[model samples]
Target: MSADGGPVARHSPARAAVRENDTVRSSLEPAGAPEPIGSMLARNAARFGEKAAVRHRSGEGWSELTWARLALDAARLARFMEDAGLRAGERAAVISRNRAEMIVTELAVMGLGAVYVPIFAGYGTEEIGRLLEHAAPRVLFAGGPEELEKVPLDRRPEVVVDYSGRASGGAVPFAEALARAAFSDPGDAEVRRFLERAAAVDPFEPCLMMYTSGTTGRQKGVLLTHDNMLSQQRALSMLWDVSENDRFLSYLPWHHSFGGIFEKTTALYNGALLTLDDSLGKDFDRLLENWKEVKPTVYFSVPKVYQQLYDHVVTHPEQEREVFHEELRFVFTAAAPLPESISRFFADRKIPVLEGWGLTETSPCCTITDMAESRSIPGVVGYPIPGVAIRIAEDGEILVRGPNVMRGYFRDEEATRKALPGDGWFHTGDLGEFYGKALKLVSRKDRVFKLLNAEKVVPTLLENKLAGMNPYIRHVIVVGSGQDFLAALIFPNYYLIRERFGDDIERAEREVRESLRKTIEAFNAEHPVKYERIRAFAVVSRELTVDDEELTPSLKVRVKNVLDRNEPVIDAIYDPSSDCDCRFLRKVFRLVPDSRKCFLGKDKTLDQCHTCGRVVFAEGAPGVGEGSVG
Candidate 1:
C-alpha cells in the first residue's frame, strides 16, 4: 500500500474517476493486471508478435526487429546470462547509445528477474566508473569501443560484451554471445517455464537501478520496481495517445529515466516501433538524415536539442521544411523548461512541441501537455496523467502520489526518507501551480535564494524570462547570494552576433553588449527592484555543451559548474570599484549571433530591437513580453 492509505493495485479507480473534461483516458482494455514488468513485456510480445518492434538504421539501410524477433533475442540473451552464472537478483549494466541491442539487453535482464542498469553513453570514464562501483554490475555491456574504454580495468566484469565491436581486447562481441547461445538453444519449454516463473514475480521486485544525473553531487542509484516503470509508461501512453502504430524517434540518452521509461519502454510496451539514432553529437547531420528516412510520428527530446533543431530549421527554412510539417505529428520536451519562443516556433509551423515535467524519482513522467486539448499552453506542462494524483502543497511544493514513484534510492535510507515524506505524497522539491487543469513549474525549492534585502528570487523564472527576451541570448544564468542585486552570466549566439555585425567581430561584440545593456536597463526601469533587476553580466563566447560539463546529458545548464568555472568573470561583474570593467560587466557581449538568425537573411530583422538586443514584435512570437520591445 502507498503511504497515502490508497490501495496499491494494478489500476486505481481514484485516478480513473478524476474529472476527464480535457483528459484522454487509456484505451487499453483494463485487465486483472499481470505481475508487473516481465509480464507486461510478455503480454505485448504475445499480442503483437508480428508487429515491427524496433527499427535501427545502419549503413545498409533500415533493419527491422519484429516483436517476435525481439522476444527471441531477449530469451536467448537471458539464457546466456543465466548460463554465465547470473543470479535472479544480480545486476547487469548496459552502457550504450540508443540501439536495438540495448533494448534487447534491458528486456533480457528484466525477463530473468535480474536488475538492469543503463549507463549514459555520454558519460566520461570517471563518471561511468563511479556508477559501476555503486551498482556493482556482474556483467557489463558496452555499445562500442568508446563506451567499453570507460569501464575501469580493475573493476572489469566477469563477462564483457561489446555490441558495436568498436571495442577490442578480451570483451566478447555481441554476435558471438548470440551464436554461442544458439548452439545450446534454451528450447521453448525451458524458455516458457523461465518466463512463467519470471511472471510470477511480484510487482515490487526491482527491475532497474537507474542512477540520477548527478547534477548536484555524486549520483545515487535509484531502484525502480516493475510496477514503477509500467505505471509511468501506461500513464504517459494514455496521456499522449500513444498506440501500437505510433513510431517514436528516440535520441535522448538511454540511461535517463525520461529516455529509458517514457521514450523507450512506453513505445515497446504498446508494440510501437522505436527508431534508434546513435548519431547524437558525432554527427547531428546523420540524425537529420535518419529523421528524413524514418519520418517518425512522435519524437521525444530535451529542450536544448529542440532549441538547436529550431535554430537549424530557422537557419535552413528552405531545406525539407514541408516534410516537418506533414510527417511530424507531435514533439515532447523535457529535462528543462521549454522557452515559450521555442514552443511557439514549432506551434506556428504546425508542430506541437509539448512541454512536460517530472523528476528522476518519479520515473520521470508525472505531467504532460495534452495533444487533445483545444490549445497548447506555451509554458504550462498540462495536466497529470491518468492514475497519477498531483497537488500543490500549502508551501507551494508540488506533491505527487503515483505508482510510478521509485521504491527509493538504492541502499540510501537517509536519502529515501528525505525524498519521500511520511505523508502519502512524495515531495517534488519543485514549486508549481495548477491552473485550469494545467501545471506550470515555477522553480526548485532548493534553487530559491535570498538577496541582501531578504527578497526571495527564483533564478529559473528570471532566466527563462530573460532568455525569451531575445533569440540572440542562447543561455542565461542569474547569480546572486547575500548580495544587493542579481547578476547574470550570458552566452550569446556568436553566429547571430557575427551576422548582425557583418564580418567585424569587435563591432559585433560592441553591438551585442550595447543591446544587452539597453535591454537590462529597460528591464530594471520596469521592475524597480534590486533583486529582480540584473545589475551586471558577462557575455560568454563559448557554447554550453554536455562534453564540457557545462550541461548535463539532458542538456540542462549545470548552474554550480558554470558558476564555479567562471568565478573570476562573475566576480569582476559584481565588483563596483572598476568602471570600465563594470561597463563590460553591465553589458559583456560576445561575437556569436543567435543561431535562429543564421538561416534568415540579414534583411529581415523582424523581432530584433533597434536600440536594445531584446526581440521585438515578430509576427508570431509567443508568451508574455510583447507590445514595446523590452
Candidate 2:
C-alpha cells in the first residue's frame, strides 16, 4: 500500500506470462512518504551550505547563490508573503521568464503552505486574464509592469510583487522585500516563524495547482501535494545516480509540469547547480554561448531544440567538443518523439538520448528510457519508474497508478472522476502497447478520426510517415475528419531550401513545390486503401507560432486551433468548384473526379485540363497560370 493509504499494484517480471488484464509496475517497492518542501530545502542547505544552489547571468559574468543563501531568501520571501495576508491553502501565481527568482518564489509559496501557480510567459492578455480569474490568487508575482497589463484589472490579485526591483503600479518590488527581510541576526522572529510554518506543512495537502496547456480544451487545474512531487524524485533516484557535483543549464519554462515539477525539482532535490538559461530555447546562438560557459552534466529539452543543436554542431565541428564535453552525461527529451537522425547524432558522440512519456496530470513522468541503454528505440518510452503502475485498457488507452499522480483537478470533480475512476488507475487518454517491458506510444485516442464512410484514420501514423519520407517537410498535420479522404498541411524546412536552391526566391519556391507534389503523388500510389490515401495537400506559407495560439509552449500543435485558423484553406481543398489564388495553396487536388483532374504531369503545367478544358493551372507556376498565389 502507498503512504497515502492507496493500494499499490505490482507487475510480473517475465513478459511471456502476461495476461490481458495485467498491471505493469516496477520491481522495486514504493519509497516511504517524503518530508515537506521546506524540510527538504533545510536539509539540503545544511549539507551544501556554501555550494552554489543556483546561478544566473549578471552583466558580463554569472552570479552564484549558495544553498544557505537560497534558504535564507526563501524564508524572507515567505515572511513577506505572510505579512501580505497570504495564508495556507491560498494560491499565489507567478508570471516570469526563467530566473533564479522563480526558484525562490516556488520555495516561498510552498514553504508558507500556499499553492504555487506558474503562468506560461507566452500566454496572451486574454489567456492570462482567464487563468488569473480561475486561480484567484491572493498575490501575483510578475517579471515586470509589462506582465501586469496582461492581467485584467478586475481579476488582478490584491497584492502584486514585481521582480524588476522597482515599484510599479503600487506593486511591491522583489528587491525591496528581500532587502527588508535581510537580517544580520540568525534568529530573527519573522524568519523563525516562517521556518516553523514550513516545517508544519502537510505532506498530503495541495502545494501546487499547475494548469494543463489547454490544447484539447480549456486548461484544467491539476492539484498536486508535496508528496506527489517528492515521490517522483525518490522513484528517479532508484533508476539513476545524481549528486551535487552535477550542473544543469535550464531554460524550460516553469509553468508546465515537464519543467516545473520534473526538470526543475530534479536539480534542486539532488542539490545540483541549476543555471538560469536566459535564451528560453529561442536564441540558439546565445544558447551555444552559455553551453560553452557551463558544460551541463545532464541536459533536458524537446526534440526541435536538439535538432537545431545537432545541425549547429555538425556544421561547426570545433564547437561539438564544447557541447558534448566530457562531464556531459545523458540527454533527456520529452513532449514529442525525438527523430532517429538526431538521436543517432548524440549516440555517435557517446551521449545517450533518454526519452520519456507522461502528462501534466501525472506529475509529467510515467516512463523513461533506461539509463543503462545508450541507443533509444524509435517510439518506445521505457519501463515505469519505481512506485508506478501501468495498465493497458481494452480500448488501447494507457492507464497509470502511482504515488506521483495528482490528487485531482481543482474545482472540477467531473474531470477528476472521469480521470480517476476509483479503480486506482488514472486514464491517460494516450494509446499505447507494450514493447517487451517498455511502452510504445501509438497515438492520442482522440487523434483517430473517422471518414464520411466511417473508416478510421490515425493522424499521427500518417503524419509521421509523411514527415519521415522527405527531408524538407518540417511538420505535417493530417486532416480529413468527416471528409471523404485524408489531406495534409505541410510546413517546409526553409533553411534547407535556401541552402539548396540559392538566391532566386521564386525559383526556389517553384522547385520545392514541384518536388513535394511528386512526393505526395508517390505516397498516395503506395497506400492502396481508399480511406488511407491522401488526396489533397497544401504547404503552409509560414510555421505556426505560440503568439498565434497555433502551438503550445512546449511546441505541440494545437489541433483545434490549427483547424479553425485554416478553415478557408481547408474549404478550398474540399470544395470541388473552388479555384484558390491564395499564397502557398498550391495543391495536389486529386479528391475530385479524374475528368476534372489535370492531365499534364506535375513537371509540365498547362492553362487547362486536357480532358475537360476547364481552366486549371498552378498558382505560382510562371506563365502557366493566369494569377500567382504569392
Candidate 3:
C-alpha cells in the first residue's frame, strides 16, 4: 500500500503535465499520460482484468466484481440507457445507498456522456422532489422500495431500475436490464462516439450535480464540471499517493461529494479496489465482521463511527488496538470536527485520525492532514491541497480558490454569484483562524449568534465543550437570541442510556436528565458568565440521525430543526417561573468568601442546601446554609 493507503498506480498524463509544468512539487505519479474518467476505467480493466474491483455483501456471502466484469456491466448499462432514449448531456440520477450497482450506474452514466445526479438515500419525498425537478434525470436507479417511494410512480424517470428485489411496482430489475443489453453486440462505435464527445467537454461543462446537505434552507444542487472532479482527484492522488493496489471500503452515501469525487473518482483514477457497504448503521456489524477479510488499506468515516470504534476498543482493552491500526495506513475524519479527546485516543494507539476540511462546493476535499507528517495539531485541519489556495478573511471566514471549486449552483445564478465571488474565491461560510500553518475552523458563519447583550458567541464551540462533558450527550444545540441567557437542547445517546438502565425507559430517561444537569452545573462552575453558562435545557429521548432530519450528512446538528422542535422548551427556559417542566434543574452552590475567588472549584465553604440538597457554602453560619434555587 502507498503511504496514504491507496493504490500504487502509475501517474496519469495530468499529473505528468502538472509536474512538467512545475505545478506540483511532489513526484508521486507513475510514468503515463492522464486519461479521462471513462478511459481511465478502460485502462484499469485492460491492466487489472480479473482483479477484484469491488466486493459487496450478499445474503449468502461477500461477492466480488472484477475490473473486467465491472467494465462489461457498466458498458451493458450504458447501452441500455442509450436504448431507453437517454440523450447526451441529460442527467442520470442514482437514488441509492453505497452499493456495487450504484458504482456501475455512475460509470454507465458517465460513459454515455450523461451528467450523474446522486440523491442521498436518506432524503425524504420533498427533498428528493427538489433534486428531481432540478436535474430532470432521464433514468433513475433506486436501491429499494423505500427510495423508490420518494418518486411518485407516474413521476419517475422513463427508465427506473431497482437493484434490490424489494421493489415490485413494475420497475425493471437491474440484472434484467443489464442482461438485455449484454446479449447485443458490444457498441464499441457508440462508446467511442460518447468518449469523443466527453473528451470535447470543456473544463467548465457540468458533469455532476451534488446537492448540498441542507442544514438551513432548501438544498442547492452544486454544478461540478469534469475539471472540478479531475482537479480534486489529481491533487488528492498525489497528496495521498493513491495507486491501483489500494483497497477502499466505502460506507458513506455515494450521493455526497465525499463518496462521489473522493471515494468513487479517486479510486477509479488510481485503479484502486472499492468495496461497497450500503449498510451504514445496520451493517456495521457486518463491516466489523469482514474487516479482517477485507483489510481495507484506506478508510474514511465520520467522527461518530470512530467514536464507536474508540468506545469498543476502550471497553475491550485486552484486545489489541494495534491490529486495527495496522490494517489502515491512513484514516480520515471529515463531515464534522473530530474532538481532541478522540484524536488523542487514536494517537495513544499509534493510529492517526487525520482530520480534513471541505464542503460540497469544493468537491469535498481541500485540506488534509498529511499521514507522513507527524505535525498533528489537535483542532487544525492541516495545510491546503497541492493546487488549492486557502485565505483567511478579515472576519475569519476561510476562502478557497482552486480547480476543484464547483462551476456554480445549478440554474441558480444568484446563489452561485453570491457564494463564488468575482475574485474567484469561494467564501466558505465556515469561520476559521490560521493557527501556525494549519487552519482551525471555529464555527459556521450562520452558527455565530449575537446575544441580547451584544456579545458574539459561536455555538459550535460551546456545543463542543458541552459534548466533552459526558459521553451520553450525543449533541447539544445552544440557543440564545434576544434572550438573557443561553439554553440548549440535548440529544442523549440512546444506547448508552439503555445500557445504563436496562429495559426501564422512564428510569433511563430520569438518570440521563440528572446526569446532564450535573454536567451543566459543572460547566457553569468552570467558566465565566458568557461561555460557561447554559441556564436551562431539555433532554431528548432519541439520538439524532440522518433519517430523522436532525443531522446533516456529515453528522452535524441541524440547528433549525432542533430549534423548531424545542420552541416550547426554549420559551420556558427564559420564563423560569412558568408552569414548565423544569424538573431537570439542579443547583451546585459553593459559598466562598467572595464570588470572584471561586474558580473551577477553588476555595469554598461546604454545606448542603436544605431545599435542594446541593453542596453549598454558608455566608456566615457554620452548619446552616443559604439555599441555592434551581
What TM-score against the true fold does each predicted structure earn?
Answer: 0.83, 0.89, 0.83
As a TM-score, model 1 comes out at 0.83
Off by over 4 Å in 1: 1-34, 166-169, 182-194, 372-379, 494-511, 525-530, 576-630
lDDT by residue (468-544, candidate 1, tens digit) is 77667878999888876687888886545544566886677656766776676666677755568876566765678
- Pairs clashing within candidate 3: 7-243, 7-246, 8-243, 9-243, 9-244, 11-30, 12-34, 13-33, 13-34
Ranking by lDDT: 2, 1, 3
Computed on alpha carbons, the lDDT of every model, listed in order, comes to: 0.70, 0.77, 0.69
Q: Report clashes for each candidate as comma-separated counts.
A: 12, 0, 9
Count: clashes, candidate 3? 9
**Candidate 3, TM-score vs. the true structure?**
0.83
Which residue pairs in candidate 2 collide?
A: none
- Of the pair 2 and 3, which is ahead by TM-score? 2
